[model samples]
Target chain A: MSFDTELAEAQSAIGDGFDRLFAATPDLPLHRAMRHAVSGGKRLRGFLVVAGARLHGAEDALNPALAIEAIHAYSLVHDDLPAMDDDDVRRGQPTLHRAFDEATAILAGDALQTLGFELCLAPGCHPDAAVRADLAFSLARASGADGMVLGQALDIAAESAADPLDLDGITRLQAGKTGALIGWAAEAGPRLAGADIAPMRAYAQALGLAFQITDDLLDHEGDAGEMGKAVGKDAGAGKATFVSLLGADGARARASQLVDEACDALAPYGKEAASLIAAARFAISRRS
Target chain B: MSFDTELAEAQSAIGDGFDRLFAATPDLPLHRAMRHAVSGGKRLRGFLVVAGARLHGAEDALNPALAIEAIHAYSLVHDDLPAMDDDDVRRGQPTLHRAFDEATAILAGDALQTLGFELCLAPGCHPDAAVRADLAFSLARASGADGMVLGQALDIAAESAADPLDLDGITRLQAGKTGALIGWAAEAGPRLAGADIAPMRAYAQALGLAFQITDDLLDHEGDAGEMGKAVGKDAGAGKATFVSLLGADGARARASQLVDEACDALAPYGKEAASLIAAARFAISRRS
Candidate 1:
């Protein structure tokens, strides 16, 4: 199958799974908050999880893919809270607190986070509980203070700074905030498939860096309508960006270089990893 | 050892473990939040955990005890948030958000929660990864929306009510908000010890109910100087309480009955559960 066909199939399946899951618990106001926050994203994290599992020779089952995506979705919801990013919109829709109340938004974020672990720990997944534990641990680390939370704190601190941020500082911030979770999705596949994780980690690291640099480039030049979020937000906020420090053309070139490095890191898996490589390239090349 | 002596030992051990754990990660601001929030309390929850573990025939290890207490402390921190309880003081000290900023409080709560699971997943614990998974899963559920978060939402909704709450409503609210976590701690002992969990669950359910009722009673009549918090705040806020609905005398009788029921539930385990039984009685009788 073509990478596009596979990606579409995976996205459809995850979207359907999430809809059912949210519908199953309709009485919870927090569930509504979660649905609002999660419904409109492009499912990049979900795609990476599905692609990673495929690369490690695991089938794209409903449970694992949905669970990983739920974690990603939940993180975004909380990360966009009034106290965090204070974002008014997400994926072209009003943010959770804007759509609901702040209390509902908080509860929704908390519930969705629990839902991620619940999906992994639910009966009838892989029989090995160790693997389930490993998946939960990885997601927790990615979302917690040592990783995404720390990155967010840095981002907030950097927003107020007068000095220009260095490449290393920006990279470290993205690695913790974005890269940690993306790397987690990739590493999860190997852990769940009972495969060695070294190569997957390498691929994940390169892909994460590529993803962030491309995101920076897109924010600089991409259309707000196409991207589904306000473009030029980083510069307006005085936030650090690869394009700000490295110039637009240099940033674009660096993104392509990172994408190539990401693809090369997946070479050991032969055709099994082709979709993941393609996805990494698409990640850097896409407008949004 | 007598229950009092054993409780003291447990508190000291937990204090030492937390001190070392906080010292180990000095760089993160969240770690400082953990330390500040954790330092003031009487360690009642820590006592319950040690008491529970003793009932299940587990040796008192600092690790599992610390893990459970860490979760307990983190919950208190989050529960006191402006969006949650809006409390400024706890145990005569400023709450996490009061001591630090709201962002720091949020991150600290997030980090401490993850730390709880991380401690459980640490390699030195028993090698039964399934059991560890179960422990982590249980803690997550008890702490998350289906448990404490739900109770908190209900509490917020109830805050503006003029009508006095009935016994059933208070029980349901406290069960999710406060009881579920205490129940989890009781069950944690057997799960960590790899013992049969049936009796432990029974003990936990009774003890949790008893603990909340006792808290309500204490909040009604206990001295503010002794309790380290303002007493009569529940009645001042016009919040529903067992004492409010049942009258102070009825509430006392009910609390005594619950203490008896809690002690009776532990009878099947013989003297091994003595500490737990005594702890249950002490939980009800103590001023704070």
Candidate 2:
């Protein structure tokens, strides 16, 4: 199948998986809010998980995919809180806080995060206990104080600081914020297989940086209606983003270069990593 | 040693464990907020974990104890948010949001929750990978949508309901809110040893109800200065607590009966379980 078809199918399957998961939960307001928060993402992270798993053998990546998506959704839920980003819209719909109340939003975010770990540890996620532990441990590292949250905390602290961040600072911050989970998702297949993750790690690091550059580019020169959220937010806030530091053309060139690096890193996997390569290319090509 | 001494020691050890854990983190506002949030809890849940581990003979329950407390601290941080309980004080100190900012409080809570999972999955937590998976999986269930958060969500929903919750409703809510984590802590030792959880489950259920009853009783009759939190708020809001549903005398009697059940359930452990029995009794006796 074409990469787009595979990605679309993966997204559809993930949506179905979530439907089954929440079907077991009571149709309460908090749960509904959780469902809403998880909905409408491009499912790129979920696709990354499946793509990684496919590079291995017949491992069930569904639960891991769902797990990563749950974590992503939880991050978004908190990020949009009034005290945080305070965005009113996400994926073209009302954010969780706007849809429900703030308390429910916070609870929904917390619960979704727990659900991510629960999914990683569930029996169906992996047959080996060691692999399950590895998944949960790696996920916690990617999400916790030293990883994703560290990046976010740094960014938040910098917002009130007098000096604007230089290139190294922004790179360090992005490494924790967006790149950590992206790297984890990319390595999920190898992690499940107990395979060496060096190649996947390299591929993911390149892809993550490229993805962020593209994101900054989109924010610098894209559309609100197409992106399903506000654009130019970084520039509007006078924040230092990749585009702001590198110039839009420089950012685009760097994204292209990183995409090539991502594709090159998958050389050890031979022809089977074509879709992953496509995913790297798509990261830079997408509008949103 | 006496039960209070043992508990005080456990609290001290857990505090030290947290210090070591945070020592590795960068000294940022978020990490500081997290430290502040976890500092003042009674560590009842952590003590339960250690006590359970002691029964299993030298299981090194410190990691699991820290994990439980981390999760507990995370819950309290969010509970004190302006959108949630909106409390400015917790454990006689300014709440995380009050001490730092709301965004930092939210990030700290999110990171702390992840830290719980990280601690449970660490190799020091258990020798067996299956056991570590079990620790993380059970902790997730206890904290997630189907567990403690479920109870919190239910309580939030009821706050704005047209009618007050009856006895059954309140019982169900408390089961998720307070009872779930208490039960999990009680069963931690048995879970580590792969022993029967039935006795611990029974003990925890009874003790949890007794604990909540006493909490309601304290809120109804105690002083805020002594409790270190606002009292009579449940009564002020016309919320039906155990003391409201069952009058103060009735609540006290019920708590005493539940305490007896908790002690009786520990008959399986016999004389070796004296401290646990004392812990149960202390639940009803404490002023805070």
Over B68-138, each residue of candidate 1 has an lDDT whose tens digit, in order, gives: 67767777876777776678878888888888877777767766676777776665555777877887788
Query: Which of the numbered candidates is closest to the native, going by highest lDDT?
Result: 2
TM-score of each: 0.94, 0.99
Q: For residues A69-148, could you state the per-residue lDDT of candidate 1 as single tens digits? A: 77677667666777777787778877787888776776667666666766766655568888887777777777766787
Off by over 4 Å in 1: A159-164, B159-165, B222-225
DockQ of 1: 0.53
Please, what are the lDDT tens digits per residue for candidate 2 over residues A1-288? 678998998999999999999898998998999899889788998999998998987458999999999999999899999999999988999889999989999999999999999999999999999999999999999999999999999999889889879999999999999999999999999999889889999999999999999989998888999998878888888889999899999999999999999999999889999899999999999989
> lDDT score of model 1?
0.76
Cα lDDT tens digits for candidate 2, B1-288 = 779998998999999999998898898998988889889778999999999888767458999999999999999999989999899878988888989999999999999999999999998888899999998999999999999999999999899899989888988898889999999898889889888889999999999989988999999999988988888888998888998788999999999999999999999789889999999999999999
Candidate 2 runs further than 4 Å off: none
